[model samples]
Target: MNGTVTELTVPTPEQVARAPKVVLHDHLDGGLRPATILELAREVGHDLPADTAESLARWFAESADSGSLERYLETFDHTVAVMQSAPALTRVAREFVEDLVADGVVYAEVRYAPEQHVEAGLSLDDVVAAVQQGFDEAVAAAETPIVVRQLLTAMRHQARSREIAELAVAWRDRGVAGFDIAGAEAGFPPTRHLDAFEYLQRENSHFTIHAGEAFGLPSIWQALQWCGADRLGHGVRIVDDIEVAEDGTVTLGRLAQYVRDRRVPLELCPASNVQTGAATSIAEHPIGLLTRLRFRVTVNTDNRLMSNTSMTKEMTALVEAFGYTLDDLRWFTINAMKSAFLPFDERLAIIDEVIKPGYAALAAEGV
Candidate 1:
């Protein structure tokens, strides 16, 4: 074994795509296929800025790259507009699962606001059922086993937090896995929906808050302390609490230390962070430091379409930027699977049976 090359070769894009991945923070409205968006737009008589899928895709990327949270979220208007009906919702949901399976995702928790799709005369229950039916159909047709669950989200700036929290509980056993509050974190804080968080907690349910992305530490502090978030969505801004001196010594502030010690998972979306101006570049992302510190850091695709990214692409970028090998990828995958809102036994099962074996095989192959 002397003078031997012991390092595992960096995984190729194909191998990375084939790796078992767990997604915890994806948005359903933000991950639609560009062509599907066009078709759905026509079905709903909705006008889009671009006529073809390619143009529409570019428009989404450019729009989201504007570095303004409000502008970035406006791109969802078209996707949500076309998803108002049951058929549209079902189709999008089915295709979402199909795409995830194709991208080699074994388990995913996709979140969306039920109230956003209710403009077409569908009750909240109907909306949830339609999406669940789509997921069921896709999973049935998949050649490889894949599990997809829903996270019922309420707009933090809205008044239906209680209603949405109740809907999540109603469908907890059906397809919904948990609850969430998502929206701009600046003006509308997670504490605005304290009632929803309290309700979920009273029921012994779990939830994540979209915090620390566009805003700073206060947003994350409020989400965790006041709102009782089980996890922090795009908790990237927690890096503000971390200071590295010029002498190369690192110090963690109280908040950062608490997040690490408490094992709170940070759903870090590298590409999406760059596109949204949360991080300057992939090389400068806090994920590098956070991962080094061994925080419960998990990689994700916050918005697949807008970011124009997939799990493979996200992993590949991290590999190139951070010199990550298959083991590092496995670490992130296990973190995500562990942080998932699924039952502890189910999460452990995936980590042991699916995720570990998948990465181990890749390592054995030296990729």
Candidate 2:
């Protein structure tokens, strides 16, 4: 007779929420509160599809779940429209950190394209200053000890990547953590921004490229081989280079093997992956196989509002799908902290002083 399969024990939602988490790929513009959007839209005289916060929230979730990355990104129009002025940027940035604190994110690096917010006649420096003001206010007010930093993103379709990379370097000590390029990945490859990437590398600055989501292996290869990215954003498509056999043996192509061997962090967002059609579902996500293979995998919520998810929600879903315990969750959190662009000492401090102890306490409670 075949051996019986034992059911995996999953952590409760409450326990999962209480566990400490770190997120490296959240979007600032993609995480505004619906009620805040309503108020901002009213002040700015912008129209919205839904009048009520509940309906607006529903609209974002439903609109982003269209299974196309381009369609999913279109939902940001409303969010970006309302976030034009300094006051609006500051308010949104502050509330973003507050929400992260509530979601049990001990450390996070929220990113957005400052160029997008400058449509209302603000300079890039003004935009960065306002957002930093918000982050400072929220950190000061938080009851729990949480650290939030900024990653300035350049739109891949645009030509301002070099300027944005310079902005990130100028603000690195002042609150900015790194740089990134994000947009539709099919036509405009990461190599298009090679000048900006080379500039960043020469300055010893860290950056992550948005690749392997809407595109395939070539995008990943360019981001890593040509651009010298420190990390890969939504790199779920790396699984395309991996093969599994009927006997459960695994084979890794050169790229996949390089990724694993070099410990190039994959900033995976499961719910967002499903919304963008990068993965079919959370249960069948490449994260499952990636984690099993000991890849440098970290869980994230790429867009909280669009994906209708939080760090806790993402972690809870993974626990339900993969039967992850507090230990697995802790490992993901540490991997994120280690992979963060913060100073090495600061990252080590968080892992040793905050994350490790937090997980130990939760495990002590049998969570």
lDDT of 2 by residue, 1-367 (tens): 0111212234689978888899999999999999999999999999999999999999899899876656666789999999999999999999999999999999999999999998989999999999999999999999999999999999999999999999999999999999999988989999999999999999999999999987999999999999999999989999999999999999999999999999999999999988777788899999999999999999999999999999999999998898887778888999999999989999999999999888777766652
lDDT of 1 by residue, 99-211 (tens): 99999999999999999998979999999999999999999999999989999999988899999999999999999999988887889988888888999999999899999
**How does model 1 score by TM-score?**
0.97
lDDT of 1 at 39: 96
TM-scores, all models, native as reference: 0.97, 0.97
Instruction: For model 1, give the 10-residue run with minimal summed lDDT.
Output: 1-10
lDDT of each: 0.91, 0.92
Flag regions of model 1 displaced more than 4 Å: 1-7, 68-70
Show the colliding residue pairs in model 2: none
